[model samples]
Structures are given as structure tokens and as C-alpha cells.
Target: MTALLSFWPLFRRQIGRLGLTLLLSVLTLAAGVALLWVSGWFLTAAALTTAGVSFNLFGPSSLIRGLSLVRILSRYGEKLIGHDATLRLLSTLRSWLFGRLFPRVPLAGRDLRHGDLVSRLTADVDTLDTVFLTAFGPLLTAALIGAGMAAGLFMLLPAAGPIYAATLILALIGVPALLLWLSRRIGAELVEASAALRILTLDRIDGHADLVAFGAMAESDRDFEAATRRLARARRGLGRAGTLAALAVQALAGMALIGTLWCGITALRHGEIDGPLLVGLLLAVLASFEATAMLVRSVGKFGAAATAAQRVRAIAQMRPAITDPKRPVALKQGDLAFNQVTFGFDPARPVLRELSLNLLSGERVAITGESGSGKSTLLALALRLHDPQVGSIEIGSTDIRTVSQADLHAHVALLSQNAPVFLGTLRDNLLIGRAEANDAELWSALEAARIADFVRALPDGLDAFVGEAGRTLSAGQARRLCLARVLLSPAAVLVFDEPTAGLDRETELDFLGDLAAATRGRSVILATHAQIPPGAVDKVYELADGRLSSRPSMRG
Candidate 1:
């Protein structure tokens, strides 16, 4: 519940539209109660009045017609405005989540799987759409309608008023509260089970090829079945709890009606109320309980909504691993240097210790090391994905930390080993590097990366659609396409982490041979295990034991 309240600020942004929707909802339900109340009174009065007795039928008939119209129109307006506001809120929520997600990329120290992250972004966010549309709106409207009916009864029948009010308060608050309590754990389990099922499904699909190759399809099936059973059990538990609460509410409504009827009968014997008026008030009481039934149905999902809110808030509230300086200095082009830097995921065990290196402008340098030797960590530090615990990385004279991340990133472009090719057109994938890059510039980048001929051979040329993760392209083709993207970036310093990875030996050698010409005017920091060709770089350093020992340049 506390987690759900945290989102009130975001919810308040749509308050105007939501408030109007709430008003229309009240009108719709009020008209329904009034329609029933007036109908009962009119019918009874007409039946008792003798022939030729002047009892006005026109006023009641007109009111009934007007109320029916109001109910129909208000109900329509309520749905239209309510759905619109909820959708807008969801849209804003997605954008805000993405903003929070970007700075936390690589999500260090978090065990968040890709599929689980997808579940939170999609299904969990969709669940919150019910927060206002079904839950809060219905609860508030029911309370208002219940109070109005109770007040009317108090004015007419003094004895029945307290009974109806007490019954209603119990039905509206007590039953739903009990349901939420009993189903809180069940609801949270249901959400987790559903996300687990989604994660497992996606994981299996992603690893289907390996599963088939290993003849483990049967094992995968068993795992999937277990997940489905967990989800089913959670759903059944929540449904059972809701069903019992609903029955309790029905029982309360019955008690209210019987108590009101007994009071009305006694009043009639004492000549305190007429049959028509008593019947009218009794029908109104029944109509008002309709609101409680709606409230019960919506509140059944409240526990799940609250749990979903907590899951989403957990992600949004995480402190980013890195942030921009309070007052950022503008980045300027100069030598890229890492001076006496030391960093590690765990402070007790450092990965890079007192490492220092410098690459003058337009100079290409290669750093080679075995896997897990912090070669990738070096590039990440340069990009400011994570700052070093001690010492500073500088671009010219400015400490990279003193500049905005956006500014630092704008000057340094990195192509990591696992770079992805998004689902879009070939042109669309390239445009991510430089949104305003012209066709000529894109073609030039592709040519430099040596993937231009393959792209041109396609029927759609640049417009050819690429599958998600570049599944449509071979490993080598995807690698080169990503390389083209980095090459297309306007950054002065280009950092490549295993840039020649995934390519055949022949293609790899050609890429290394042409490295100098391809990045003529920009400084290149290449981290790789590939053999560097003569003239490929001005210098090479092999990283061992968290230190760099420079090897003489192979360049002419």
C-alpha cells in the first residue's frame, strides 16, 4: 500500500481528467439509484390511488426518462475520459522508466535478467493501468453514492437510517479490506509467478537452438510445466479469496435490506410512513448496494496492483552507478589519458591498479589481454560508464568526471563485443549512430566497415529490414554492421572492444590492415586479441596483472 501511494505524484498529473471522469461516474450511479427509487414509488402510489383520483404521473415519468438518459450519457463519458487519462499516464510512465533505465545500463551489481526486465517494463506497467481506471475510481464513486443514499434514508425514516449506513460502511470498507489482507501474499505470488513464466518462456525461445542440439527439449518442457503450475496455483488462490469476500458482501446487502424493511413496517403501523414512501426508500437501499458490488469486484485486483507498484518502484528508485557532475565543463578535443587509475566491482579486489596510458590525437593504440583481464573495463572507464576508485581519466586537460556524461559520450564512441543490431530497417539501425547522417555519409561508413557491397546487393538496399539482434545477418555481417554504426558516429575518439570479433581470419586481417586509413583523423583505442598488422597502430600494450607494459609499435 505504501508502494502504491508513492505513485500518487504521477497519478496527480492526470487529476483534472480523472476528477471529471469521477464526477461523471457519480452521476451515472446516482441516476441509476434515483431511477429505481422513483420507479418503485410511482408504481405503488398509482396502484393504491382509486380511479378518477388526480395523482400526477407526468412528473415521475419525465424524471425516469431524464435519469435514464443521464445514466447512459454519463456512463459513456466516464469510460471515454477514464481510459484516455489512464493511457496517457501509462505513456508518461514508460518514458520516465526508460529515462531511469538508461543511466543504470549494465545495471552493475543487479541480477536483473533481460526477460525479467522486459516483464517489468511491459506487463507490470500494464497492470498499473488498473490502478485508477478500475480500482481508485470505483472505490471513490461507490463511497459517494453510498453516503448520498444513506443521507436520504436518514431524512425520511429515522430508524432505518443507521441500519442502512452501518450495513453500507461494512460492505464498502470491511469486506474489501478483509479481501486485500487475505489476498496480499497471494497477489504478490501471482505477479511473481506470471513474471517468472514470462521470463522462462523468453529464455527457452532464446535458447531453443541449443536445447534442440543438446536433446534437452524434454527437460525444457518439464521446467515450463512447473512454471505454469505455479502461476495457476497463485491465480486459483486469489480467485478463491475474492469469491469468499464477494459472498460476504452479498450477505451484508441482504441484512441491510431486511433491517430496513422491518423498520419501514413498524413505522407504517405507527402512521409515521406510507406504503409508497417505504417501498421507495427500500428500493433505493437495494440500488445503492450495487455500488458496493462494483467496489468489491475492483478491490479484488487491488492487492495485485499494489504488489506491481512495489516491483516498479524498486527499479525507479535505484541510485544510478554513475551521474553527471553538478557543474560540468565542456569537453574539448585533446589527448585521451588514463592516469594511475584503479577500479574493481568489489573494492577489496581491484581489477586495474595504478594504470596509466596516453593516446595523442590521431594516434591509434592497441591493448591486448586474455579474457577477464580488465581490457573491457579499461574502455568502459574511458567512456565513463563507471568512474575509477582512485586517479582520473582525462580528455586533454579536463577530467572526464568533471564533464557531463552526454558531453563525454559525444566525444568518445565505443563498439563493445556484444553490440546489438535493433529490429528495424538497415537504414534505421545506422541512423542511431547519427540521427542526421545523410545517405552519402551512411554509405561511406558502410564502405569503410567493408559491409557496403552486401547491403547494396539486397533488393531493399538501405531500407532492408533487419531482424531483432541481427538474426537475419550472419555473425560476421552483424559485427561489421555494428562497426559501421560506430564508424558513423562523429566522436573524435573511437574505442573498439574486440572490433574484429566474429569475423573470419581473412576478413579480420583485412580490417586490421585498413585500420589506419579507415580512422585517419581520429584517435583509436582498440582492445583485442587479434594480431595487429604492420602499420595498423602506432603502439601496442599487453595488459597483465592489472598493469600495462608497452610493446614497440609495429607501425612504419
Candidate 2:
């Protein structure tokens, strides 16, 4: 219920469009009922006139023709207006939800299932359309059409009006309520099972390289197939409830039509209404019930909509792992420091213990450590990806916890290990570091990273497709591309985490040699397990056993 209410703000913003949409729906249903009623009366009157019961031929014919035209025009208008409104509504809804969740999504998703998160953003969010199309619109139109029919019948025949109104009203409320209850559990089960299926499928596709390395691709395939089979079964389970509810709703509508016919016959015999009038009333009642009958199918799926809402709301409301201080201190130095910092991804196994280091302006420092020895954690601490549980990290004189994330990032930029390459042109990936950087600056950064010639060699150059995660480029080329991207940043300090992790020995040394010329006046910290030769950096620190020790040479 709370998840459903969160949309009230989005609803308020679109009130005008939704109102027009509902009004058009009411108008469309009203026209259908009106046309049916007018045609029935006209046919009956024309038949009596042929038998010498005086009636104006022109008036009846004109009434029938006019109602038919209104019905056709309104039906077309209703479809156009309703669909336009729905499309606009869905776009606004997706944009609004994405904007709310994008900021914290990176860290918030660290503990979340990747496939489920995608499902939430894509499939689950789409499920909400049922709330609008099936639940909200149909329920409102059913009530409006029902009330209008009841009011008209009351003026036509007092006794027959209550009888027909009561019968139709019961079917509208009772049938939907029963269907909703029966399918509630099935709806939730299907949504959950589908989300699980999406997660397993995505995991297999995304971890293709790792699965092949470990020869587990067959296992991954089997897991995906199992999930698919389960989802099919859950869908079949929900269909059973839907099928039963459909039959029940049709039976109710049939009974209401039969009752209307019986009521009209009794009313006509008692001199309460003429033959044409009686025929008109029975036809109107029959057509009006159609509006409510469509709602039975939608109400059964309400549980799934509610469950999807809960998932989306939970993600949107997740607190960020890092947040800005209420009053941030000035951040104006290329110098970085960590003072006896202690931290961990988990409390029982701390990654950094009393770690301390300092890199002043124009200095190049290298920290070499074995795998899983907290090399990346040091960069994360300096960037304030997460605050340390004990001690403090500082930029200049202010503790980093006192500096806003924006300020910290403006001073320090990290070219991370296995940096993700998005699916876009070469220019789009580089723009992430500095959105406003021009072509000349981009060329300069690429030249510094020793990849300018490679890019210029391509037919489309910067406009060429990079493919998903830079699948078009070799591992060495992708790293250089990422390095070029980082160089485009205006941050005073450049941090590189294993930027050449998988490169050949000679190429890694050559890349390291180029770093000095590229970052002449700024601070640089390169965290890696690889050996850095003399002159590539002014100082080297070995990070092992959760401590940093100064080294005089490239020796371990």
C-alpha cells in the first residue's frame, strides 16, 4: 500500500492528462450505450408505425443515424487520447523513478543481485502500467457509466430502475473482489519467480569470461535453463486463476442481461412504458454491463503490481554508503594523507589496519602489494567511497569525512582496475571524466596515454562504436583508453589502481615511463602489484601485512 501511494506525487503532476483520459473513457462507453438504446427504440417504433401505430419516420431515422455517428467518432477519439496519455505517463514515470535511484545505485547495488536490480529497473517498473490501464481507468469508467445508466433509468421507470441498477452494481463489485482475492498469492509468486529467472540468465551472460576460465559455462547454462523452466510453471499457475475468473465474470454478465429482459417485459405489460421505450431500456442495460465486465481480468493482477511497487520503492529509498557532511571544509590541495586509518568491508576481516601515507604536490608514489592486500581499498578510502570505522583520512588539513564528496572528487581521480567501458563511441567514454572537454584536449589525453595514433587510425575515429564494455578493443588498449579518459579530468591528483594489470612487462614499463611526462605538476599515486623500474616514480612504498614500508628500489 505504501509503495502504491509513493506514486501520488507523480500522479499529481499528471492530473490534467489523466483527467482528460478518464473523461474520454466515460464519453466513449456512454456513446456505445446511447447508440444501442437509440437503435433499439428506432427499430421498434418503425415496426409499429408500419402496423398503423402513428410515429414520425424522419425523427426516428435521424436519431439512429446521429447516435451511430457519435459512437464511431467517440470510439476513435477515445483510443487516440487514451493511448497518447498512457505513453506520456509511462515515459514520465520511468524518468522520475530512474532519477531518484541513479545517484546511490552504484554502491546500493553492491549487495544486491544484479539480475534482480535490472528486472526492477526494467520489467518490474513496467508492471505498474497494470495499475493505471487495468485497475484505475477501468474501475473509474465502470462506476461513471453505471451511475449514468442508473440515473437515466430512474427517470424512465422508477421500479425497473432500482432492479436493473442493483443487479449490475452487484456484478461490478462482487466479481472483481472475488477474482482479486483468488489470484493475489499467484500474482506475487509469478513476479518473484520471473525476477529470479532474469537474475540467473543475466549472471550467466555477464560472467561469460569467468565461467569459461573455470570451465563452468555448462553449469551456468544448466542453471539458466532451470530458472526458465520454473518461471514457465509459475506463469501457468497464474493462468489457471485468470481462466476461472474469466468464466465467472461472463456468467454474471449473462445473468444480468436475462434479468433486464424479464424486467422490461413486466414493465411494458403494466402500461408503465411503451414498446419502444421498454426496448430502449433493456438495450441500454445490456451495453452498460460491458464496462464492468472488462475489469475482472485486471483486478486479479493487482497483487503483482503491488509487489513490484515494493521492490522499486525499497531501492529508491536505500541510503547511500557515503554522504556529504552538513558543513564541508575547504578542499584546496593536491596533497593527500591517511592518519592511522583502520577499515574493512566486513568487521571480522579488516582490509586496512592503521594504514598511513602521504603524497605531496608534484610527487609520484607507487604502492606495490600482493593480491587482496588492500591496494584498491587505499584508493577507495582517499576517494571517500566509504568512511573508515576508526581513524581519519585528510586532504590538506581537513579530515576527508568533513569534505563533501564533490570536493573530494574534484581534487582526486582514480583510474580503477578492470574499469568498465560503456557501450558508446570513444568520445562518450572519455567525456565521463570531463563532459565539456573539447576535441583538442581529448587528443592530448589520448596522446599522453600512447593511444592517439590508434584512435586516429580508425575510420570513424572518436565516433566509432566501442561495443559493450569495449569488446572491440584488446585488454591493453582498453586500459590505455581508460587512462586517456582519466587524463581528461581536471583533478589535481591522479590515482591509478593496476592500470596495466594484464599488460606485457615491456609495455607496462613504457606506460609507467610516460606517466611522468603526462602528470608533471600534479600528484600521482599508482597502486599495483607490478614492479616499477627506477625513474618511473620518485618514491615506492610496499603495502603488505596491512602496512606500508618505504622501498629504495624495485625489489619486493
**lDDT tens digits by residue: candidate 1, 1-556:** 9998888888898999999999999999999999989999999999988972688989999999999999999999999999899899999788888888888887877878888889999988998866887789889999999999989888889899999989898998999899888888898999999999999999899999999999999999999999999999998998898888889888988999999999999999999999999888888888898989888888867878988988888888888999888999999999999999999989789999999999999999999999989999999999999899999999998999999998988899998778899999999999999999999999999999889999999999999999888889988788888889988999999998998887889888887787788788999999999989899999999998899999987865
User: Could you tell me which 10 consecutive residues in candidate 1 have the lowest summed lDDT?
Assistant: 48-57
Best by lDDT: 1
User: Model 2: per-residue lDDT, tens digit, 1-556?
Assistant: 5687777787666677777778877887888898889888888877777655466778767876886787677767767766776677678778977887766745632667878888998887788754776777888888899889888887987666776676666667876777667666777777888999888878777888899999998888888788888778777866777777667766766765666667767778888779988788778887888887766666766778878888888888888778788998888674688889888878577788888888888888998988899888888888888788888987776798888888888889988877888899999999998999999999999998889999999999998899999999988789889988888999888898998788898878877778877877888899977778667778898888888999885432
Cα RMSD, each candidate = 3.4, 3.3
What is candidate 1's local distance difference test score?
Answer: 0.90
TM-score for each predicted model, relative to the true structure: 0.87, 0.88
Which lDDT value does model 2 have at 67? 69
Report the backbone clash tally of model 2: 0
The best candidate in terms of TM-score: 2
Question: lDDT for every model?
Answer: 0.90, 0.80
List of clashing residue pairs for candidate 1: none
